[model samples]
Target chain A: MEVNEYNACVREWADALFRFACKCTGQASDAHDVVQNSFEVLWQKRKEVETGKAKAYLFQVAYRKSIDHYRKKVKITFAAPPEETYTPANPDLKKILDRALAQLDDQARALVLLKDYEGYRYEEIAQITDLTETQVKVYLHRARKILKEYLVSVENII
Target chain B: MISWENYEEYMMMHADGELKPAEAQELMAFLDANPTLKSEMALYDLTRLTPDESLTYHDKNSLLKPEPVKRVISFPKWRKYAIAAGIALLVFVSLFKYIDTNKNNARIAKTDTTKPIIPEPANNTSNKNEPQPQQEPKSIAATTVQPAKVTHATHHDIHPQITHNKQLANTKQNDNALVNNITPAAKATTEISSLPITTTKPLPSEIAMASPPMATIPAYEITPPAKPTKRSLIDRLPIDEANKRQLKTIAHITSGASRSVSKVKEEIDGNAITFNIKNNNIHISF
Candidate 1:
């Protein structure tokens, strides 16, 4: 891909990648950093990426960066928040949804987000997440079951 | 064909639109049988995380414009070496020019002795504080110190320092001749350093005269302390000053008949050594 094609990728995919990263990382700053790092990786390997697979390539990098960032944040939370260690009940639908998403482990949450938000196929998600197609299906199914159970608590859901 | 355990797989496939039409119809029949589980479809909504209307991409379109490329310039290693070498050459040239200028200045200062500094053509050519070494042959004092007394001593056992006076006399024969001409006394009383003519500094007018008498009085006082050894008897001889020069002879003589004689015989330029110890006489000549 050329510079213009990369710029087009940035313009078209930055928002989607940023949204996926934000949901995965639970922070705007971390999501922004993830998007920036993903795009930088894309720019470095632009020569190797096919023009048709730019979105997958971008999400692939962003997905990996988000997983790493999520692990680091989880480690930091464990180190810093001894007093606020208990999970407070979040009533708002959006906060509850975020909490439900946060409850999923890294690969399961990434699997569900790649499937639902980005509409990536099982094979494409497996390629992006570096997993087998069957593994993606099983993990996504588990993540959805968790989300359904969390939402079932509310009588009138948003 | 789907069992209760496979119901989740079917529902997930239905939610993902991956279920066949027949499987979808079966999944809807199962959901109709369990109406309370219908709200579980909320997983579909919960899974989709669309960006909020308030959220933006932090102006990603601005990134399409190229960032400015920074250029860094640096000098190479060879350039630094060249600069250092040029400075060294410049310093070397400046030092050379400075030394050459000093040499030229000293030469100009020396040759400026144009007039006859000593109006009477005196023995001391040390006027103007510059030694005039060239006015030796024609000076009145130049006729005194003989060439034989000033020949260089080359004996193997001789000390370089004791024989150094003969070397100085040979090199400055013109000045030394002036020293010898100061008195015909040729006396052992006056040492070479006590010469009145070579006194470069001021002295008392009476003692400064060409008077060996006062000098001989001190020599007489110092005589008792002198041992009467064979070296001293030779030292008392007037010809002792020539010992530093080429030895003319060593005569060892006795009135008795000859017992034995040991001589170092080497012939060079008519120099010879004759040891006649039987008569207690030894002659070594150069």
Candidate 2:
């Protein structure tokens, strides 16, 4: 991709990539880092990428960076109790949804983000997450089941 | 195909908008038949996350790159070579002109120094018939004598007296007889006879010194000098005192050889060798 096309990708897809990173990483700061790193990788690989594929390329980079960040966070804080991880001052629907997204693993969360947030097809998500289409469909369905269960839970729904 | 075992997959695909329209209708019909599963499908619909429009990357300007600059002018290979060749030719022509100018200046200086300066004679006597007394031949140092005011004289006009005296000296048997004929007054008059004589009027003193019979002396002609030539310029250059001594020594040697040669030739064929020291010319009678 040329510079202007890469920059156009940034303008069109940066917010969506950031939201996907935010949902996968579960922290605004980590999401910013993931977004920044994803664009940096895209810029570095601009010559190899085409303008049509730049959005997918960016999401792929952000998905990998988020997985790495999530792994590092898990390794460092493995002893911490899951109940103490999120303490929302005011629990709204968006905060409840965030807590439910945090319950899924990094890969499942990225699959959900690519599916719902970016509206990528199963095949495109499989390409970005480097999984087979069947794996993506199974993982995304499982994630949706977990989110449905969390929303129906009486304590969490309130 | 929509059964309880595979019902959740249809719900997820329907929520993701991946199901075909007929399958979506089939799932809705199956949900209508199973009234309790209708609420389960609604919960699946809630799983689709709507992107918050307020969420944005604030630092997106940093990712943009500037456009590449365009070149204003470019030269072809032939044009560059032509420019270089033109510069080289201009320098070569300038150097050649500079060298040629220097050579011309040097040639002018050399010509000025070697040019002969012909001057008029002090005594303008040009009497051709009178036998003038011969002057004692001076060394080459006498060449530096100051020139007279008159600008030019031919060899015949200037040296008529010398030619007459030479013929007389040739006829006499003894050199002392020729020396006795040169009176003291004539000797004084001919002191600077090395200079050309241009005047045609005869002096009273020369008429008195003409005691020898003019009829006995064979008439000889001296050629006149024309415009100065290269040989004349070389002859006019001043010789140093040392060079004059060397030339005198060479002249003495040559004179001795000439005397011996004269005697031998006179005995064999009545011909003689005559050497003139004043002008460095050798005459041979054959």
Candidate 3:
């Protein structure tokens, strides 16, 4: 890829990648580290990557690095629910959804974030998660079922 | 055709908004017929995670800035020179080894060296025909060239001179010349004139006949004059440059640093000076 094209990739996708990493890792610092490392890896391998495919390549590297980062953080902190849900002028439904998202596994939450947050296709999510399309569909269906049940429970409580 | 019974995949695709335009029309028509499923499918969108602008980093300019490309591996500067030095040392060592082995091979091939040949006893009865002058080197060469002497390596040195001396001996000036000429075998010998000749009783003629008579005599007199009657007083001696400087320094010291001729001469007349010059010792008695 040309230098300008690669630099454009960095400008265009840096925020999207940071959002994905931030949503996956749930920490500003860890997400920052993941995005930085992913972009650094992309820069190192920029010559081999095409300009059009740089986003996918960056996501692939970020997905792997974020997964590793999540695993390291997982070991130190058992999967506890978030201490407090930071709600900012969001409706109760959005708050409930945020709480439900915090309840999902790192992989499931990342898959959901990639799907709804980034609108990645099932195949792209499958590539990022190292899963078959069928498995991605199955797991995403399960994650949606869980979130639906949580939403239903919050509605009944209200 | 697009009902949930036959193609639930199409329904799920429709829920994800993955349907193409024609499939979207069919899915909308089917969803219009089944009004309950439309609201049910809307739940997928309601549960979908929104792109929270708060979550998306805005100051990602720091990240968006281009880092220097790191594809090239930079080796330490010393590594290039070290590799070059290693190759040069390898070549130099190989060259040295090659030359060393060849030198050993050459040494083995050419083992010949020049060794002085000595003559044998002069005072033999059957050697009455032996010329007294040629006795030293001739007897030595004859003995060495005899069947007992395995060292014929110097035979080249003996051959040319032997041929020349044999022709001279063949000239036969007188009986003295005849006696010398009779020992034609002596002409083939090296000149061993520096060695003092020793006389012993002659062996039988049988042994004398077995030896060659050639000898190359050096031009110096075969015998030295008798030893000096007594030591004589020496007047002066010539020395090399270093000793000459030392003499000047001694003369200057004794001449009250003037180094004047008469004063140094007076200093020299008072002392007996002994010195060695050109391997000869001289003693001056004042």
Task: Please provide TM-scores, in order, for all candidate models, with all chains considered together.
Answer: 0.44, 0.47, 0.44
How well does candidate 1 score on lDDT at residue A85? 17
Model 2, stretches more than 4 Å misplaced? A75-92, A155-158, B69-286
Tell me which of candidates 1 and 3 scores higher on DockQ.
3
Model 1 C-alpha lDDT per residue in residues A62-91, reported as the tens digit of each score: 888977886666453311112121132533
Please report, as a value between 0 and 1, the fraction of native contacts recovered by candidate 3: 0.48
Q: State, as a TM-score between 0 and 1, how close model 1 is to the true structure.
A: 0.44
**Cα lDDT for residue B251, model 1?**
36
Better structure of 1 and 2 per TM-score: 2
Number of the top DockQ candidate: 2
DockQ per model, Cα: 0.25, 0.46, 0.27
Q: Which lDDT values do the candidates have, in the order given? A: 0.62, 0.70, 0.63
Segments of candidate 1 deviating more than 4 angstroms: A74-95, A156-158, B33-53, B65-286
TM-score for the first chain in candidate 1 comes to 0.83
Estimate how well candidate 3 is docked, as a DockQ score: 0.27
With candidate 2 superimposed using the best TM-score fit, by how many Å does residue A132's alpha carbon deviate from the native?
0.5
Per-residue error for B252 in candidate 3, Å, reads: 99
Residue-level lDDT tens digits of model 1 in B64-182: 64855679877799998999999999999999999999999988878767433322222222223544433422322223333333322121002111223466435456544554677
lDDT of 3 by residue, A1-158 (tens): 76667778877888888888876777778878888888888878878988878888888887888778877763533223443432334455655677788778877887888888778889988887789998888778777767766766665565
CAPRI level of candidate 3? acceptable
- Residue-level error in angstroms, candidate 2, position B177: 99
Lowest summed lDDT window (length 10), candidate 2 chain B: B134-143
